[model samples]
Target chain A: MDITDNKENMTEAPVLLSVRGLVKSFDGKTVLDGIDLDVRQGEVVVIVGPSGCGKSTLLRCINALEPIQGGEVLLDGQKIEKDGKNLTAIRQKIGMVFQSYDLFPHLTVLDNITLAPQKVQKRPRREAEEEAISLLKRVGLEGKAGSYPRELSGGQKQRVAIVRALILHPEVMLFDEVTAALDPEMVREVLDVILQLARQGRTMLIVTHEMQFARAIADRVIFLDEGHVLEDLPPERFFTEPGTERAKNFLHMFEFEAVR
Target chain B: MPDLGLNVLLKGKNMQRLLSGLWTAMRISLIAVAISMPLGILLGVLMTKKNPVVRAVLRVYLEFIRIMPQMVLLFLVFFGTTGAFGWNLSGELSSIIVFSLWGTAEMSDLVRGALISIPKHQYESSEALGLSRSQTFAYVIIPQTVRRLIPLSINLITRMIKTTSLVLMIGVVEVLKVAQQIIEANRMASPNAAFGIYLTVFLLYFIVCWPISMLARRLEKKWKD
Candidate 1:
């Protein structure tokens, strides 16, 4: 199989987010080590690896959700520091959707979406509710606004979570295995929303196990193994002809599973 | 057996003393609840802090209150303070202070449990949404904690009310104290007055606490649903 590299396309676009020599550890165990990458505006970067390979940790570190032992992250050329002044303001520009959805169980769906806008952004209640309603309608959840998180299916909850993050108008979106916890039947709807976002030219960093979905959406695919970025190539090259032996073995396992 | 005691109850000033005593008990408990709830909640949130020194201090205070009997605490505040500190505190004030201390400790534990019970994901999501620490607590953490705390706190309020009966030992003239006074006053005319007066005190306590217990149950059920 012949696969062309899109490295030229990446170099021409303006980078929206960048990571430099990122390192993270927990309880003296290194989870991410010497990671470096760039995500251009309108780029959809997908990260794939086996369990405990630090895919989620990298995303979390980028979002400043996890503390890093070393290195730095920049959003639109501004350094993102964990203890920096205006950290909350910095975080406002990045949105993250977790695997569990993590909707506030005590709140209605509409309230869940509007909370950050009204409270953090200082938007008027009426304005926030109006925007939330429209967002919900766009996601086909208009009638379910009054319902609780428990009242919604996994797909609906995940969609609501996406909407909740989107309402902030984040510069970049991070999806950490958003569909890993969803039922197989429900995964499509959530993924469909993400695809729609991708089509709209939104910058996204996604960690996923769905190889076909990664190929379908990723401009670039990063293969991480044991806290190292083994391969960073365009989707075609990463899939058809992985560079490192580790990448090749990883893809081989996936192909074997597909055949089985 | 009941004829003389019944007469004593209907007699002038006897019923009035009991009612006045009940009023005193109610007032002290309500005041303690009002004062202690907020203080307890603050202490409770502090209890969950990462600072070992602060947590250790709160833990010691909480454990001390839990293990020391309420009656003993009442005496310590009422008599010990008067002797050691020379403050000359009234029985009513002493009761309030003792109960408030106990209530604050209990409330803090409840608040801490409620706060800790909140899943870590909620805080992460709140932070990700750009909410500051205070904003997260106000909008997310506190609301859920309050819901979990209401039933338990209400039950504590009822316990405080009943425990105020100990104030009689300090000469507060609460219901039990009034019952003793009436029994003593009518010892010649009403030999069984003690039984009837004590029964009335028990009935009054039951009437006050039973409704509160029911309300707590109802709240627990409603919030769970």
Candidate 2:
């Protein structure tokens, strides 16, 4: 299987997740206005925008974490709704990692990873523990499974958080700035884990500020401004030949920061 | 002048009566706690519900309990209920009923605060992990809420114990009422008995409440981590 061939086929790939005319509002103020997006299986879609542009809210709406005021999110062509009876089933297929690494403070890393599997999936405790250890080892956290979230550094906590989501074997993962809260040095370890997942052909929708990482990993980059998609293109074209002035100015700021 | 009241307190049957009165007070508080704890937790969880009607009703109930004096509540339940409804409410039962009402209101508020204080991310993360609402509460929300509530609830427990002395006003013959009886009996023989008996009552309350407050403080420190 040629890597370039797979990339070429992405345009016609079957959609694993689809967002149609998604709208969200908080206290009568719209945060996400008529947004649309799609993620093909094993494809990486990165969303970039300035602060408060509704980037995070879009990811939350996709997972049904936020109630949408209008439109629908479909996973494998099935509607995701706030009041859906099978929300847990729908959510099981879409794992999310938060920026703060919301690991259960009372639970150890291993327990945190294994909790959903044992409790929701009804997997045996021993089986869940074995799988958790393997996933932990994959992230180079094999020895830290016994540590609490507070005892770990920001990077370690985020890695464990990613592993916690991965153990559920979600078909698509939503990463909401998983590195935003980390120190400069710690961001790499967490990003490396995510990059490794991308290498393993995981379907990921990421909202990130790391322009370089977004450029490196994204098959398609979406530029959002003021709750609307300003541009959606391949990273190469998005960086060099942005179609809109809004996107161009956005990229120009990053370029100026890079030189400084 | 030389602490004659102390002798009256140690006289024939006065000490025994006080001990029994203390027993009555302790028993009433324990029963009230046992009933209120589960009831309060349920109400607290209910208070977090999104339904406006339920919230409004619970809010009214909480405010009513908070604003009404516990002594007045005891009177209403004991004498008023008997007079109005013709129901036979024993003094001890009335004391339990009134305290349970007060305890439930206080406990529910503590629980609500604990539940709300949990960070929003905890719920979101649990939901994203595919845990059902019940699973989220049982495993994620409840554990954190319980840790936060234990110390506060323990403080409420001590408050309930101290407040049980109010039942004496309704003729329950609790420790304070027993002390009053002893003082009245020894008015001619032991002029200073009131001072001695009241001191003993204070010490008895302190003995019961001090350890509990200490325990709450220690727990608050331990769970802070």
> Can you list each candidate's DockQ?
0.63, 0.69
Q: What is the TM-score of chain B in candidate 1?
A: 0.93
lDDT of 2 by residue, B120-198 (tens): 9999999999998899989998888888999999999999999999998888999999999999999999888888899
> Which residue pairs in model 1 clash with each other?
none
TM, every model? 0.90, 0.90
Q: Supply fnat for every model shown.
A: 0.79, 0.88
Candidate 2's C-alpha runs over 4 A off are A1-9, A25-34, A69-71, A255-260, B1-4, B78-90, B188-190
Q: Which ranges of candidate 1 are over 4 A from the true structure?
A: A1-11, A252-260, B1-7, B82-87, B187-195
lDDT of 1: 0.91
Quote the lDDT for B166 in model 1.
91
Error of 1 at A143 (Å): 0.8
Task: Give one digit per residue, the lDDT tens place, for model 1 in A94-116.
Answer: 99999999999889998999999
lDDT of model 1, residue A137: 87
TM-score of 2: 0.90
Q: Please report the interface RMSD of model 2 to 1 decimal.
A: 0.8
Taken over the whole model, the C-alpha lDDT of each candidate is: 0.91, 0.91
